[model samples]
Target: MNRISGLPRMLAVAIIGALSITALAQSNPYDKFRNREYSNKGYLSEADELKLAEQVHQELLKQFRLVEDRSLNNYINSLGQRIARRSQRPNLPWRFYVVDDKSINAFATLGGRVYVHTGLLAATRSEAQLASVLGHEIGHIVGRHGLENVKRSQKYGTLAGIATVAGAILGGQTGAGIGELAGNMIAGGYLMKHSRDAEREADFLGLYNLRDAGYNTGGMVEMFEILQRVSQSSPNALGSILASHPPASERAANTRREISEHLRGSDQRGERDSSEFERVKPSAPASSKPPRKVRPRN
Candidate 1:
């Protein structure tokens, strides 16, 4: 009789242990990202992305100085939009900005916002090299990298709570806490961190964008060399830009292999430089001020 009674208690214990394991798995914030397909856009709709982008833009205005020269803005927009038109999401309200900072970096955020530091423009050897950098950034948006990373980060319970605050702000509601969370999310680099696979995918897509848009594919390879050189000489210049990417030599080698194996004719056929690029390049002098650097969360 005692054995039979103990069996019921033992079965109950087994069930309780199973329940505990299930709960722990469910609570794990990163579990969902492991098996996800990042090819498709993440949970946010286009409109929602734009709304979030607008908020982030406001936060950026507080952090960096933007070039206000009409001619410079128009030139970058025209070049960026040309490459953007060849992307998977061509109709996005594509906009580009020249950050008046002397850091060799460029980054993209939600809703087609791309920022290139003055140092990056000053560092390029030709229009093709500049366009290659622009294409790489556009490739990230084409793959919805930023949005997917943001969604993954949102799975953390406390950070998940920030979504409700984000929604409230987007829906025209306001609070100090809501605004603060939104700013912290951007300032903290939550939206900029990407996995190695994502970085590789962007490089692949960027090469295609460069090719399809009539620029020499070799520019992508050259851009990698420039990046590698700067990284070796002045490590701080790249800051967070190269932190999550593969080593520069590896990237350049891969790009060259891709060009030789698949995109053979592209390296030789396209335009290598442009007069317009020369006109706009000199205006982007490196700033005397130090750039704002933020350590990204892993």
Candidate 2:
């Protein structure tokens, strides 16, 4: 009889242990690394991600000057913040910068840092288009692309080099040296392209993100169309985005399907453009500026 009683206690212990393990697995907010889940922070801790983002942000400022206009910054921030608020990592203190380059591209780094080119701003016909781009970038962060890159790159090795440099930066490395290294990795031509799976996930996340932020999902479709148009009309003007991801046509097709399947019946209304976007867009032109008028040519 005593032996039979012990067997029940043993069974109880085993069941409790299994349940505890399941609970722990479920409790972790981040997904398992290999699962390709959106909102994954990947292998990097949040602190490390922030440090890398700071370094990258510093490098971006050094390589491409940011627009000095406060109004322009505020306008981008307002929209970016709206999209980010609906993101999985809504509480991450996000930062948005307008790169002075008119190159028709935008990218997101670690933490919540995102950069938009002046060319892209000029190209977008509506605020919704801008939100689409920004939402895609936010998806990258919420998906943790930069950290994923570090994990996958044989050359980076958890970025041992960056760790050393980052330590030095915390101590004595000048901004220029760090900027050169990071700029080469980013702007100078060494960007790590995200996988097709990651790209598709970003598009999905971005699509929903805009809709949740009350922006029209159609904006994402239009943005993809703009990318396709740019790729066909001026391939060289395609910039880093196309170089890093799949073709715009594929992306556009996917967005159309998503709208059909998920968002077709929804009545979520979002702003297509704001007075601020209209007022500040002139300051962020694509390509080149028109020549100034000469008063005394006659």
Candidate 3:
């Protein structure tokens, strides 16, 4: 009789142990990410993303001087709109900004907002190169890389929760919390460097956009060449330039290989440069001073 009773008790213990193990597994987010179980549909809703974007944008306005020239704004908008329209999230209200910062860097945020540093604009030799940069940034949005990063960080429940708690402590609107999350997320998480897989995906998407939009894909290669040269000396000084994008050499070689294998027999030579681009290039000053635009749209 004691043996049978002991058997029941042993079974209960086993079940409880199994339950505890299951709970532990479920709580660890990295396991899900490694197993490809993370949600791709996005962790946040469209409304929430838009709110976060607005909050971030407002913060940016106070931090960086924006280029408000009309011609330059229109030129960038025309280029950005064309590339963005070909993307998966074409319906999103895409807004591009020319940041007056002279750093050779550019980044995109939620809700289809992209910021191109004046230095980056000046660095490009042609419109096609500029498109390549814009295309890559757009790829991040359409590929939902920022969202993936946010979700990955959310795996750390404590840190993610702190964002919400901080917002509540501030006692502002719902958007305020999201804005805080965005600022922190970009500063330390999302908008920083991306995984190799994410970088490859964005590169391919960018090349596709550039090619399909009637631009020579060689421009992508040339742009990388310029970047590689820009950093060949004192690369450390320009670490921010490759903060999110991969090394220029690796990217250039990848583009060449992809073009040879997939885009074979296509026109390797399309419009390489444009007079209009030359007119607009100087608008991106090497200094932080706001460049003249025809009008301010963004």
Candidate 4:
């Protein structure tokens, strides 16, 4: 074989190195999620997630009329902080707010900002029931479920862009408006179906959070039952909530089993209803007339 010159050999080595780097960069961004810690990866770094959360929180304050009752807001904030401290991404700045809309709905965005509708709060029968709902929404945030959905959507190219842009656009709109838009966007059938596995994971994790927050785990099952009943009586009334989370009877059963197996016979002595939940009722603005019930959009 002819001896290669130093320049040619250097050029060949450089080309090989460049190719290797390109291949590494082109590898799927999701490969890391294949590990058991997948749920943990979808989140932005703790600081980044917190920053985004603050941004989203400000946007939410602008979009929705925040419940003004000081005691009510404080109560919700305390409960949320207590539960959030026990979440996987506890380092992120978490906040909870009550919206003035009279629709049975709740939602969480990319960060830790969560919104509970006045209707949902008014409809809940007990503190445990309220915690169950909040815990589930918290589950979506800590589980980084939305981020996973965004990633999966991105894999499909233009459709993914459309979905993300739509989410961002609708996310900036009013609470009821976003709820309606999200319901339609999800139902349009372009987004990847959330794996049943993910749903099960969220349910289990949410129950864990609820229990840790001193709520009866039975509340989780009760919420499901209530949703099912509502769906049967007035599907359109709960369309937004149902669209985001498709309720399953099996999910209720699974939560019940988890409770019995994991939490049965525990002390449960300190878990009592919060007076704040009892004291706070959904209130309308002082300047506004009597609140009108707004039906969920189809």
Clashing pairs for model 1 are none
* Model 2, runs deviating above 4 Å: 1-42, 154-184, 187-192, 266-269, 286-298
Using Cα atoms with residue i matched to residue i, what is each candidate's TM-score against the true structure?
A: 0.79, 0.75, 0.76, 0.66
| Model 4: residue 255 alpha-carbon error in angstroms | 0.9
Candidates in order: C-alpha RMSD to true structure:
14.1, 14.0, 14.5, 17.3
Model 4, span 40-112: residue lDDT tens: 4543444544443454455444456766667778888888888878877676667787777766777766567
In the range 131-170, model 2's lDDT, one tens digit per residue, is: 9999988988888877677555524554435545445555
User: Worst lDDT window (10 residues) for model 3?
Assistant: 29-38
**lDDT at 177, model 3:** 52
Better of 1 and 4 by TM-score: 1
**Candidate 3: stretches off by over 4 Å:** 1-42, 161-175, 236-241, 265-267, 286-298
- Give model 4's TM-score versus the native structure: 0.66
lDDT of 3 by residue, 1-298 (tens): 9999999999999999999998756532212222132223645666556666666676566566778777888889889998899877788899998887667888777778998888788888888899998988888777777666655666666246534623443454654555556566555645445787777777878887788777888888888888888888656534373554677898898788778767874436666677889998876674645354333123
The candidate 4 region of ten consecutive residues with least summed lDDT is: 27-36
In terms of TM-score, how similar is model 2 to the real structure? 0.75
Local accuracy of candidate 1 as per-residue lDDT tens digits, 112-206: 99999888888889888889889989988877988886677777753554577556755766555665666777777877778887787778778
